[model samples]
Target: MQITNEHNEKMAKMTFSSVYPHYVAKVESKGRTKEELHQVIAWLTGFDDQKVKELIDEKATFDTFFKKAELNPNAELITGVICGYRIEEIDNPLTRKVRYLDKLVDELAKGRKMEKILRKA
Candidate 1:
């Protein structure tokens, strides 16, 4: 699927806290804890618990949230389909990164092992 600038802009403008409840619900409904959600996000974005809370409290946009992140070195290892788009095939760097987080949360909801989800060595 072709990812357009308009879609990217829309996603960029979305507030992290606004979307966070859905993410929490997605995993918590499947018996996952909020801390696990935080772990996966931290692994993907290199944000500590406090920093993640700060972003949520500030109601940061996806652009602001990711801009302040130190993305993990293994982020490139995240690959596969998310919302019908293949992670490895996404051409827009920012969209790909956003989708990577989406995919990670999807996997967490699907009960993927924490070590694998975090792309641990």
Candidate 2:
């Protein structure tokens, strides 16, 4: 799918806090705990639980959230389609990061194993 500049701008301005609840609901609806979701996030973004809460509290936009993140080296290992776009093919860095997290959460909600979700070797 072609990602437009407008799409990138919309995603960049989206708040992590706004998305966090949806992530929680998605996982929980699939029998995954919030902790598992947090674990997946921490694996990719290196934000511990407390830091995640703080980010949510601050309403950090995707741009700000990613800027503050120390993304995992293994994050590059996350690949495949999410939101109708290939994670590996997204050219905008911020949009790609957002989709990486989305794909991980999708996997979590789909009952993929935690190790696999964490991109374990």
Cα error, residue 3 of model 2, in Å, equals 0.4
TM-score of each: 0.96, 0.98
lDDT per residue for candidate 2 within 1-121, as digits (tens), equals: 8999999999999999999999999999999999999899898889999999999999999999999999999898989999899999999999999999999999999999998898786
Give the alpha carbon lDDT tens digit for every residue of 1-121 in model 1. Answer: 8888899899889999999999999999999999999999999899988998999999999999999988989999999999999899988777888899999999999999999999887
Estimate the TM-score for candidate 2: 0.98
Instruction: State candidate 1's TM-score.
Output: 0.96
The candidate maximizing lDDT is: 2
All candidates' lDDT scores? Answer: 0.92, 0.94
By summed lDDT, which 10 consecutive residues of candidate 1 come out lowest? 89-98
lDDT of 2 at 109: 98
Candidate 2 wrong stretches, greater than 4 Å: none
